[model samples]
Target chain A: MPFGNLTYLVGLIVALLIYSAVGTVFRTLYLLLLSLGFLGYISPESLVILLLVSSLSYACYSGMRGQTNRSLWFFLGVAINLTGLFFFREFSIRESWSISSYSVEYALIAVGISFYSLQNLGVLIKEKLQPSAMTIPFTDFMLFSAFFPKIISGPLLRHENFLPQLSPDRNIDWVPGIQRILFGIVKKTVIADRLAYLVNHNFETVDPTGWNNLIVAHLFALQLYFDFSGYTDIALGSARLFGFKLTENFNFPLRATSITEFWRRWHISLTSWLRDFVYTPVAFGLRGSVLGILLAILITFALSGIWHGLALTFIIYACTHAAYLMGEFLLRDFRMKIKVVVGKSVFNLLGWFLTVNLVSISFLFFRSTSCIDALDRIGHVFSCSNFFPSNWKSGFIYKIAVGGDQQNIFNLSITLALTFTVLLAEKYVYRRLESNKIRVGLMVLFMVSIGLFGVFTDLDKFIYGQF
Target chain B: MDNLTQIEAVIRKVFKDDSLIIDAQTSADDIDGWDSLTHLQIITEIEKHFSVKFTLSELLDVNTVGDIDRIIQQKFA
Candidate 1:
């Protein structure tokens, strides 16, 4: 069940209580079983794949401990993980290439393989670096790979960061964990789902126009941010209940003033993974030249795009970001000169505007049916007639936009209001509200708001869960 | 100059901040503009000054100034 479901919430509470009573000796095994149960509930087939992949990684890691040919083990482990990832991710294209049909039935069952494969591969690299120092016990490693909270979507836990925090002796901090869960529920149900209602409606029904597409694209960006980040918050809070800490996935990315800064903030763990594994190796191979860095950016982002899913729109989405970062790099000196001319504040404001628009426009490719559709929509955005606000009112603006049915108008208003309010609150209210009493009060308010405003009619699955 | 001192000098020149002070523990986090791009420039400058080249693995292994110093010392040996 998804985190937003009532059944899942009840199950979580019961799990927390049971977990608190369990002693340290059996805690790891207990949680591992629970994680398996969660996976079994989601997809029994995926649980088997997870167990197989985890076993292979563990076997490879064990083989490396005393071996002179550790690189052999490392490469073997990496190859296995990548092959699993590739088969699962690119299964549909196999027919075109005439690959064997023997495993075709199992293709769609690898739910969390993409994320766990990265974790397993990272462990190999760490083990290769410090042969004796990084050995994890089998049980701990299994739990780390299949931990229920982050298994569906991830903050992409690293072995170095997560292994230390996995001990069974730690105590759960109940209040903050529950608070985080409630806050995440508020973000997902109350804000993101509501916004998705408006965004999905417009994208599906409304004819593609420059004005409408632009607005929907921006809304989709918000919808995506809230959906994914909300899922992360729940994952983090769930991990916290189990006395484990997950890496943070976002850090107020919308406030980023540059594309590089944006990557550092948005989906921080994934970008860092790409940086460490893909970009660093490639750039280093090219002797750390300017050209090398550019090429590394290209290769890393292209892989990143493919990681999200192998599609033309996703590729374009990835390339758009790659281009943004490269532009920032090449224009750094020019931007600095401009920053000196205009004061820092004005320069930052302009940067924020440009970054938000550029990111939102790229989401068009991300959300589109195909790259060509996105291009057509973008083309419409620049057309002379489409650019005129007066022309939009003829039918596009009034009927489908501001003057739509009462429900549509209400959703549009609430979406905009919640988006801006949350943004402003993050900037002003939440940062300064440090009092315990006030925090508790706000938590209650969030719960109440979720009950009243949360869209439960057609529950939406967490968007990142698919990836 | 000592290797640390030489490394410090190269950092100061590449970052264009003469007043910046560094120690063995100094890292990218300690400097204002010592980002990934500037890091490449610093490494390039150090390679030029010391007449040495670092492989991809070696560069990946260097996280702090002390790490770089140790690598250089090992290379010299």
Candidate 2:
């Protein structure tokens, strides 16, 4: 067997055995073996990095357990690991040198390192923060970080809430947990994967010369949302299956009435993290003064941009959002006054329009590679004014969507109907339906649509997965 | 009508709502401006007014201006 396959199978067998046995010592030993086995399979440098990270994670764990200064050893370990990885990936691997930049093979996988690092560091920080709140033992904390379902792409676990649950107090309700996993399976396999086909096709070959690119962008936007949200659903559900309840990552974000609300709904855990740890602190730091507020917004968004990547496109995207948010803040009181004067419907429509367009514009940033790439795409959408995509003309579905080599009434009808149904279901219909029968019905329908029309296939990981 | 006057003043100033008036029994429902985000602002402001810092649990447990006043009195007394 290949080394990767052999290690993977062994890790799973050991974990399953330990998991079935269910003891602190057994689980910890299994995980340690798993980590070592994982390291054994990878490159020597990565193995070294893994050892360093494991040491850091363990230090953070021990620090939280002991209620000390979070093990400077742990902090040093994590900082060195991250900084070193960053240097290796950014400078050396990209350029091709050892000291002078050459890591030729170029496949530097830091997969799950960030998740583990953040979860552990968050544990250390939260321990330093609350001291008495409660800390899970080193074994539980390590396992929580390494939990197979979320280790790779996470609902980005944080330890503050995760720790207390790890103790014996948690009551694992297997029925609902299993049900959640079922929902996730449906979402990932049915809807997300289905949508992935069209979305991937559109983005991979979006031509800037005509109106086809515009249609492609719109398709990509919806595709990206489903792809990311679908992965989150699966992760959350999978966590539930294992008796650990992970947080929801999406809450009908596309149905949000405003940009602020949209953010609160989309990738909810990450947004919450940004708000609580990043946005709030920065915003609060700038507390009383307008300049302080400006500085806070700038810093928060810049950090968000950096979190996405070191790309100019990401930076511009963040800046565009910052500009809109500032404008929204400045105009908040004025808009309220407008609502009083222009009537509720007008005000709401305006707010929703601003939100949708703002999101659409920023998503373009998320999609594009560089500022120029983004700008060229935007130019094509707004200025090209002609030439529909020819590929979409092939299938009846494609014809119905973008056109017979152009836009179609059927596609618009379907999109509008689906969009309307989702909005009503999220907003009103779900609230009215209190019966299990109805919910099951809805789920069945959701599954059917996802299975039939959803996108999936060679999906890149979730947008937040990179962070 | 007691130190409710002082506490309400702090609440109004913190929420930037000069028109807000509340009695001992008044809840956040009766006080329109008092939402969770602003509620924290109110607690922090109340803490500043009384020169006291609220622990996270204490802040989490509070629901009203009177609760704020009582916590303050208990702490400072």
Candidate 3:
């Protein structure tokens, strides 16, 4: 496949124009959506399936007018959405002759469905219970569901949060929006993309044998964090430009000393969603039982794991997290005791290092293709079996990067460093946004980032574009 | 009469907020520590101390310390 899916690109531009200047917002919105969906490689049946399920729910929501059983209907909506996803993925993958060889193929069009399904589901349910909240015109509701900024990936828009923002008649602060766009571009293009080289190199090879490989693994962890969170920053910043305040996805997760705390900070929105909608119910209903907590941990992580794809690697990834959380939960009292007793900087740093290493090991599941592959990779890494040892010399590093991956190690390092610095800088930017001076600083930073690196062409698509 | 002192003590004990004061009009909204997440933790501790289980609806509907105290009074009285 070529780099550009030109059909979707053309379709996206047309849809945007229509969205920006349409008569009846609902009808225009519908037509625009129809066009975007058509741009993708979906079959007639799947397209119909998508439209039918969505329309049915919206129609029910409109008709009920605060009269229907909200929870039951909402669950039904999720069921329908997940079922469609299952059928498309399960059936297509099983059948050797599936069309387009995209059993669970993703492109531009599928960007918002994962997040939008939840948004629309929440809206429909909220309609029956809190009708006054459903003030969005049908058109705006559709836009909110398929908002381009978050459609590909999400800060998982809550319906209650998104709908009202759509109706905002406030003046557009062009300056802030442009600044956010600049920050997003730097995170996505320059830094994250650069770090991606090292991350991908380390993950693609089975070697974890040498100290170099170990360092690579650590770098891989950093790279993954940068890439995903960088995407999220862009997603959020873009969402902000339109006056739609998406939830913060990352909260300086590298600072977290424990897996439990890391998840709470990283992908905070989705993890929180899984907690509120999945984990909490399971844990609470279990009533402090160890078995309950374990089961809840497993189930939540499993779903979280497979949310990436229907693959064994993801399954392992989930299990690793499940184990980490369970271990942390089990050792909570013991840890608090330990913390109180030691209460030292060295102990805290060691704890953080140990926790990060454990997390990196878990990423083996995410990076590898299968459980066996993941286990083998971990075995090699631990056993010091250097499958791809680095020379460590500047000359050799340059050669391996240039002659090897068609990318230079220096370029990768500089990019990753710049990206990391920007994110760290954003920590200051976030706080300083309250001040005029820092806001001006952010603009200068933004301009420098823009002049340095353009927006990622992949901006229209999220990393988790497939599932 | 197990007046405000007992209720206040329970609030202080449950939240580790010895400064918590309970009065007739005092509500969860007015207290800095009275988040809904921690609300049940307090209720559960109170139930352990006083020996009663609240109905689900009652648990969901609670807004004030006085409301909880009144409910406890009703059951015990």
Candidate 4:
């Protein structure tokens, strides 16, 4: 079920209450069952696939113990997980390779394999390298794999960090968890869903005008940021209610002054995963060389793009990011020289401006239906006839949003205002406001805002849910 | 120099922060500008100074200065 669903919210509350009251011995099992139910509720086939994969991994783990060729078993485990991920993500009923009815059915029903495969691989690699660092009990491992909160889109957990926290003796911090959930609801429903209205219009326009492309480019970035991070907040909050802590996935990535810094902040878990497992390994032989760095970045990002899906648009998206990072690194000395000339404040302002636009422009590929579609939209930007922001005051907002209605304007205004409010608070206000009363007031405001402005009728699934 | 002292010097040189202190427990999280790219530079410098090549597994396994030191000492042995 979508985290934004009312039923999911009610279910979360019930689960949290039961979890808190249950004894330590039963707590883990209760959560494991809840997770199975959540997944089984959505796609029973997916739960079966998850169990099969988990069982295979456990069998491999058992085989590796006290064995001479532990590496063989470890690699087999990795290969199995990778095979499962690729098969689910790539295979379809339309493909000629769908030899049987069962293959077609399983391909269609597979869910969250993208996320759980990474989690499973992490355990295999970490345990192989560390050798008996933590002997995870079977139930704890199962729960780690199927934890309902982060199973969909993750603040992807590492074995060392997550496994240790599965103890029954953990204490619950009730208030902050509820506050986080409320904040997430406001972020997802009140802010992100509203922005999705305009963004969806922009995506649908076959012949986007220059102004349309330009405006929606930035809006899409904001829409995605709020949507994914909003989902994260709920996931973290839900896990928090159960006294389990997940790694944070975002750190105000939009404010990053450089693409390098942006990747460090944005989708931190996935980037770090690529860094540890993909980039580091590939770059090892090529370390301490400029060309090597560039090459490694290219390969890693290409893999990252492929991980999202096997599509030309995603490939272009990946290449664009690889190019950005490569360009950023190549010009580091130049940037430093310019920084010296311009002074830090001016330099940073310029960097922020360039980074934001570059990042936004790259999202064109990510949001496009195909590479040609993305290029067509970008082609609008260079057309001399559509150069000026011509439609301003007459129907600029209407053109961008594709509607001139009172309700549309209201939703757009609230989205823009809330977006800025959230940024400003995260950057400035929230840190300084240590008062519990004020914090509680803000929580209540969030609840009120959701009740008032939340777009409940046409709820958009979290954008990252497809991944 | 001992492994820690040598590592400290290499880190300071690579990061261009001579004032930076170092210890066995020091890791990427503890240092500024010690991101993935600069990390390779530090490792290369250490390899050059010690005349030892680290395997990919060894590199992956090294989380802190202590891990690096232990690996280097093992190589020497």
Candidate 5:
């Protein structure tokens, strides 16, 4: 179920109450059952797949315990998970194999299988690498793999990081949890949802005019960040309520000054995962040869693209980033020399502007329905025939005015003002606001603003949940 | 030269810094032009110079010059 749903809120409250009231012995079992129930509620088919993957992982871990052909067990575990992912995600392959319609439908509904399977795969690899590091019971392993908060769209928890927190002695910190949840709710319901309207409308246009496409491209980029990061905040907040600390996925990625820095900040868990599991291994296997390292980076990013979906657009998006990174690598010394010559502040601002625009342009591929559509939208950005901002000003103003509704204008103004205020505060005031009173006051202001002016319509699905 | 001295010479040559000094804790962050690209070049040069082929896991596991020193020692001891 979506985190925004009332049923999920009620369920979380009830579960937390029961969790706190219960003794230490039954806590794991109680949370495990609740997690399984949540999974089953989302899709019975997914629960079945989750159970199968978890069993396969545990069996692999057991087989590797003695270090006899641990590599074989690791490969076997990975093979099974990949086979499941293939069947679930690559439906066209199923069609070629003439798989039954009912089976295809079942595979399609298994939403969280990709994320949870990867979590289990990481566990298997970690076990193979350092057998003595993890010796958790099977039940705790299951809970780690199937935790409800992170199962849907993950910050991709590591077994080592998350396993120790499974203890009943872990203390629940409600203050940060409440603050994060409130921030997540406002970010999603207020900022992302409002921006989604503009993104959808402009992207759906058959022939977007110049400047319109550019505006929409940037809007979609912002919309995606707020949508995905908003989901992450909610997931992290929800997990924190139960004393589990999931990793942060975003770190002001939009403000990054370079593509390398951008990747370091954006979707941090996934990139780090690719770095450790994919790129490092491949690059190392080739003995760190120059060509090998470059190829490893390309291959890792391509796989990351495939992980997003089977779409050509996603592949293009990933390939573009890989190319950007490669370019950055080749020109690092030159850029550093220029930075020294130009002075740091001016160089940083220039780099930030270029990086943001480059990232924004590449996201067109990510947001578009197909490669052709993305190309067309990108091509439209330079067409001078429709570059009349004056002509489009009234319509643009009207759209933001939400069809000239006075209430919507008020709502939009509040959202814009609050968004700028939050950004400025984060930039200027956050570190200085050391006192609890100031922090609490800010939280209260956020809560009151969200209650008063947050957009409640459409309540669209999160962008990253598809992957 | 010892293993560390040989490794330091290889790193200095690959990164084109003649006056570079490296110790156990030295990493990419410590040297100019020591990015992923140059790192591969240094690794390739090390393998050729020492005639020791490191496994993928070994390559990945090494985070510092100290780790490399130990691996080289173990391989050549």
Candidate 6:
């Protein structure tokens, strides 16, 4: 079940209560059962697959515990988990192979298989690398891999970072937990869903003009950020209640001055994971050669693209970023010299402008249905007829006028005000509210605002869950 | 020049900062242009200057100047 559902909230509360009453000795088993039940609620078939994958991973690790060919075991573990991920995600391939319909049906319902398999593979790799340091019990590994909050979409927990926090002696922290969940709800319902209306409308437009397409791209970027990061907040908050501290996923990514800095700040866990697992290894193998470095980046990002999906658009999106990063790498000396020529503030402003626009432009591919659609939209962005604002007044006013029923202008005004309120809250108010009473008040206020202004009809699913 | 001085010169030249003074505790955060890109450049320059190669793990594990110094010492010893 999606975290946004009322039933899921009820389930969460009931689970927490039961967890609080359970003894420390049974805590691991309790959490493991809770995670399994959570997955079962989504799909019994998925739950079985998860259990199988987890069991296979645990057995592989156990077999490799004292083995001399630990690396071989690690490769085997990775291959098994990756095969599971590939089978579930690529239904077309299964169909082509004439796989049994029952297995295909099972694959279709496998929701968190991608995320959990990666988590399991990470554990196996770590164990192989430092066997002595990663001696956790099988139950601990199960709990770590299948932890409900992070199993679906993740702050991609490393075993080293997550396992130590699973000790039975930890106490639940309620204040920050509730605060984060409430904040996530507000961000999702108020900001992301509200922006989704405009984004969906404009992106679906067959012949969007220059400013219109640009505005749509920017809104899509914002919508994506709020949607994914909002889910992350809920996940982190839920995990916190269970006394687990998942890694923070986003750190105000929109404010980054460069794409490189943006990666460091955005989807931080995945970026670091790819860096550690893919980029570093490739770069290391190609050390002391610029061509090797470039190839490593290309391979890493292509894999990142493939990880998202097998779509051509995702590949373009990843390639666009790789190009930008490589360009930055090649132009480091020039950038430094430019920084020396210009003042730091001006340099930063220039960097921010270029970085944000480049990122927004690249995301056109990510948001588009296909490469052809994205290219057509990009072409429209530069067409001579669309460059002027002559047609913008009527179009813009109509879009914000709520179906063009009345030109009262109140809807547009309210949208701008609400957008600013969400931005201000994210930037300032949310961080400054420290006292428990004040946090509770803000939570109530946020709930009331969401009730009043949230786009409840045709609610868009969290964007990153697909990946 | 010794390893430290030679490494310092390589860092300064790569970063285009002549006034750089790096000690054991110095890290990427202490310098303006010491990002991952420049980091590779610095490593490459060091390897070329010292005629020593670093493994991928060693490159990843080196976080601070002190780590670099130690690795270089071990390589040359």
Top of the candidates by lDDT: 4
DockQ of 3: 0.15
Worst-scoring 10-residue span by lDDT in model 2 chain A: A95-104
Cα error of candidate 1 at position A138, Å = 0.6
The DockQ values of the predictions, listed in order, are 0.38, 0.20, 0.15, 0.58, 0.39, 0.45
- Please give the lDDT score for candidate 1: 0.78
- 10 residues in a row with least lDDT, candidate 3 chain A: A94-103
Model 5 C-alpha lDDT versus the unseen true structure: 0.75
Off by over 4 Å in 1: A93-107, A205-209, A391-403, A427-438, A458-460, B1-5, B15-26, B29-33, B55-58, B61-77
TM-scores for the candidates: 0.91, 0.73, 0.75, 0.91, 0.87, 0.91
True contacts kept of each: 0.16, 0.00, 0.00, 0.68, 0.42, 0.26
lDDT by residue for model 4 (A1-467), tens: 45657888888888888887889889889999999899898889889999988878877776677567788889889988988888866664224221111122234636778887888898888777667745777888888889999888887888778888877797775665666776777778877777777777757764446766877888888888888888888888788778877898988999988888899999999999999888887788888787888899999999999887777777889999999988877776687689879998998899899888888888888887667878987888768786556667444677664677887667667778878888767645334332233376677678788888787753436777767
Estimate how well candidate 4 is docked, as a DockQ score.
0.58
Q: Is the docking of candidate 2 incorrect, acceptable, medium or high quality?
A: incorrect
> Residue A405 of model 6: what lDDT?
55
When 5 and 6 are scored with lDDT, the better candidate is 6
- In model 4, pairs of residues that clash are none
Give me candidate 6's interface root-mean-square deviation.
2.2
Q: What CAPRI class is candidate 1?
A: acceptable
Comparing only chain B with the true structure, the TM-scores of all models are 0.96, 0.81, 0.84, 0.96, 0.92, 0.94
Q: What's model 3's TM-score?
A: 0.75
Q: iRMS for model 2?
A: 4.5
Return the candidate ranking by DockQ, descending: 4, 6, 5, 1, 2, 3
Q: What TM-score number comes out for model 2?
A: 0.73
* Model 4 error, position A189 (Å): 0.6
Residue A206 accuracy (lDDT) in model 6: 47
Worst 10 residues of 1 chain A by lDDT: A96-105
Q: Against the unseen true structure, what C-alpha lDDT does each candidate score?
A: 0.78, 0.56, 0.60, 0.79, 0.75, 0.76
Worst 10 residues of 3 chain B by lDDT: B32-41
